[model samples]
Target chain A: MSPVLVVLDLMGIFVFAISGALVAVRKELDVFGVLVLAGTTGLGGGFLRDVLIGATPPAALEDWRYLLVPVVAGLVTFWYHPTVGRLERQVGVLDAFGLALFCVVGALKSVEYGLGPLPAALMGMVSAIGGGMVRDLLAGRVPAVFRSELYATPALAGAAIAVLLDRLDQPYAVSALLGASVCLAWRLLAMWRHWQAPMPSGPASV
Target chain B: MSPVLVVLDLMGIFVFAISGALVAVRKELDVFGVLVLAGTTGLGGGFLRDVLIGATPPAALEDWRYLLVPVVAGLVTFWYHPTVGRLERQVGVLDAFGLALFCVVGALKSVEYGLGPLPAALMGMVSAIGGGMVRDLLAGRVPAVFRSELYATPALAGAAIAVLLDRLDQPYAVSALLGASVCLAWRLLAMWRHWQAPMPSGPASV
Candidate 1:
């Protein structure tokens, strides 16, 4: 990976890890729980995508830095959860940035590994959302994305845009920037507007 | 994979999917949720292991049969849930069978992928428990294995035994059978005796 991509990936992981740790703290989980949630949220999406694409032992497993970032984030959250909880808005913005970066990177990587456009885009969304889902599961809650604001749709759209641009012979830098911007902009808009995904119209039958 | 192994694998998937669908039904999730849970429970463990081992597109994605089995299982449970729910004891027995089959198969597959014995055994336990964890997460519950009976430990033991026998040049059939039997027997004993894993000794710190 290029230096810029690597930097963005690590930043994304850091932000996601912090979010996971915050959730763990709120749930009154132990320090071990905080660390585990951090690690899972930071790396779970990439791990899922890589495993699906046959990338074994994932980059997180191969590099100490990747593992270290989450630990640091977890410890920070553990020690300063009150402050972190107070800064929810800022964290939400950072999470949007992370989501944008993950979607584009995940799509491009899937394409590199020979996935078709549809599957690549889906993988991108998965890469953006899978970690959060795992985190919520470990934290004993329904995943926020499944019931919250427009999150996955933006990720999928960004991924699709990236894949389309790449297929149209756009430079990697151009495609990635445009794709990430699309996701980031859409996510921010959803947050600002308090947009929600559609829910089941009727009561769920038992 | 051999025909017998394939059959066994399908059977395991069927049982796991049934369990997942049952959870969804009890949770009053929509039909979509039922199918999603079934698919996740049937395939989640292998997906995790395969990703770690660098096996891409996972067997479920590669073969139609693998995908078909879970869908069938989900539909069955969804339509016949009252009957299926009433058959909880029988279902529990079948779940033990599925767990036993998965631990051995998962361990052997990890070994084939050149993992060390310890990792292979761990992977086996993961393969046996991963799906149920996913199911619980989707159903908005903590995973039962983390706090319930001696589920994961038995899987680890069976997987370890399989790996050890394989190292000793035991025939694959012999190793697999013995390993599966160990898991099945232990799981049954745990169920019959109402055995539980140890939990945290005190209240979780806030």
Candidate 2:
């Protein structure tokens, strides 16, 4: 793997882990619990992706950086909560960036393995959401993406765009950059406008 | 799949869901949480295995029985706690049987995909433990297998035997039976004797 790509991947992992630690703090979790949440949220998606792709030892287990990145992210968030707490939305923005980056990476990896476009796109979605799903489950809440938030929609859109760009014979770098931009923009717009999916009226008016 | 295998698999799913629901109840989770935990514990392993093997839709989403099994299991446990609570050890026994049987099944499926014995055995272990790992993570507790428990050891042994037997040209039926027997016996023994892997201690203590 290119050093640049590896660095980007690690950055994505760090952002995801910090986001998870923030959620745990919001939920009033202990330090150990926060670490567990952060670790799982950072590595869980990539672990699932690797396992499904038949990558041996799984990336989460093989890479020392994968282990340390999340722990450090968790520690930083835990120690500087008062200051970091003010940047909750900024954290969401960073997480959105990670989600976009990881989704493109997952889709490209799937295509490299000769999977069909549909399967590749699904893998992208899985990689984006799997970690958060695990984090939510551990935190005893419904997954944020499964709720009114437009979390997964952005990832799906970005993946589809990346795959389409690739099908058009675009350069890998260009496709990845555009895909990340798509995800980040969509997520930011949704957050700024308070966009949410419609919820059913309560109990049929009793 | 054989009819006998089908029935046994369904039974295993039911029992595993019950096990998950029991844990949720102990944690005082709500009804939705209970269902989510039970469903994940019952189906997560097989789902991970199938997805890795490129099986579409996965078993949990394909068959109505797979979905219903966990729901019913959870509801039954929720409604009849005193009755179900008294048989916790018996549940462990059933869970061990399920682990053994599923390990063989998972290995056979991996082999059918033309993977090596090593990967096939690993898949079997994944199919056996993925659900419980998800459950423990959701319950905000370390997974039992991650600790000193002999839980994962039995599954590993069963999977290795199944793969080895298959490599030796044994019939699937015979290999599966032998593998399941080894797993069940080993797990039951571990449970009965409170067997565990040795934990690390300080240098002086060791």
Candidate 3:
């Protein structure tokens, strides 16, 4: 991995961790709960992908820095939650970058592990959204991806693009860049436009 | 696996899946959601344990029977939810049986995959409770495991016993039976005795 990519990846994890910490603080969870939420929200998607693809001792678990980023983020939010909560929009934008990078990287990894293109793409989306799902579950809420604005579709599209390009022998950097751009642009646009996923039509059967 | 164990495993999945389906119906989720919840509730724990242990393309995914069981269970609950809901007590009992089988099977599998005893035992508990956690999450609730009476502890104890017995060179049948019995008995006793886990004292800081 290039230095730039590595930096972006870490930044993504950092922002995602902060989001988790903010949620924990809002819920009044203790220090341990806050740290756990931060770590899972930062790294849960990759852990899900790695475990599914038989990558034992997930990369996050093997690397100390991965563990450190979330803890620090959690503590920062725990102490300065008011300021952090006020900066939700900025944090959300950074989270979009994280989502984009994770989608492409996750898709590429699954493809390299011999999963079919569709499954790989699905895995990519999972990599991008799985952490938030875990965080929401732990916080006792429905996952935002299920009802939030156009989040998963963009992720799926980006992953599909990356997997397809990689399978066609495209350079990793090119595939990643194009895929990340698509996801990032779509996500930012959705946020700006206030796009929403369709909810169930009519009264649901009781 | 022996024929008997295979049957027990399937039964466990069936009961767990039914419980998930019931939750979905009560939540007024559509048929698709009901099926999804059933499958995840039945199989999520094993998936978690397998993925963590680097067992890719989880056993439930590879086997058609594994996929079929949950779908069938979901359909059954969807069509007869009124009757099934009334039989909640009976279902709870069956669920205890499922939990017992899952913990032992999960721990034994992890130990076979070269996990440390403690981690293997933890994985076992995960396998038993994980599906319900996923079910609760999808249904937009906190998981029962964190607050439920004498649930995870029994699962862990059962798993520890199985792992320890296996390490001591006991036959697989002997190890599994003792572990399952211990778990089943404890769980049934808890339900019968109205046991509750200790909750935090004092007012939570908001």
lDDT of each residue in A15-112, candidate 3, tens digit only: 98998988898899999999999999999999988888777678888879888999999999989999999999999999999999999999898887
Please give, for residues A1-206, the per-residue lDDT of candidate 1 as tens digits. 88888888999999999999999999999999999999999999998888798766788899898999999999999999999999989999999999999999999998898877777887898899989988998887877775567888889899999999999999999998999999999999999999875433333334
lDDT (10s digit) by residue, model 2, range A1-206 = 78899898888889889878877777665555566578879978877877777663455544566677888988877777666667777778888888999899888888887888888887887888889988887777778887856888888888878887988899999988898789889988888888887778678764
Write down the lDDT of every candidate, Cα atoms only: 0.88, 0.81, 0.87
> What CAPRI class is candidate 3?
incorrect
How far out, in Å, is residue A200 in model 1?
A: 7.9
State the weakest 10-residue window (summed lDDT) of model 2 chain B: B197-206
Of models 1 and 3, which has the larger lDDT? 1
Candidate topping lDDT: 1
* Model 1 ranges off by over 4 Å: A1-44, A47-101, A114-122, A134-142, A153-206, B24-40, B51-90, B114-122, B134-142, B146-171, B177-206
Give the better candidate number (1 or 3) by TM-score: 3
Structure candidate 2, residue pairs in collision: none
Per-residue lDDT tens digits for candidate 3, residues B122-186, read 99999999999988878888887888778888899899999999999999999988998999999
Candidate with top TM-score is 3
TM-score of model number 2? 0.58
The pairs that clash in candidate 3 are none
TM for every model, in the order presented, reads 0.64, 0.58, 0.64
RMSD, every candidate, angstroms: 6.2, 8.6, 6.3
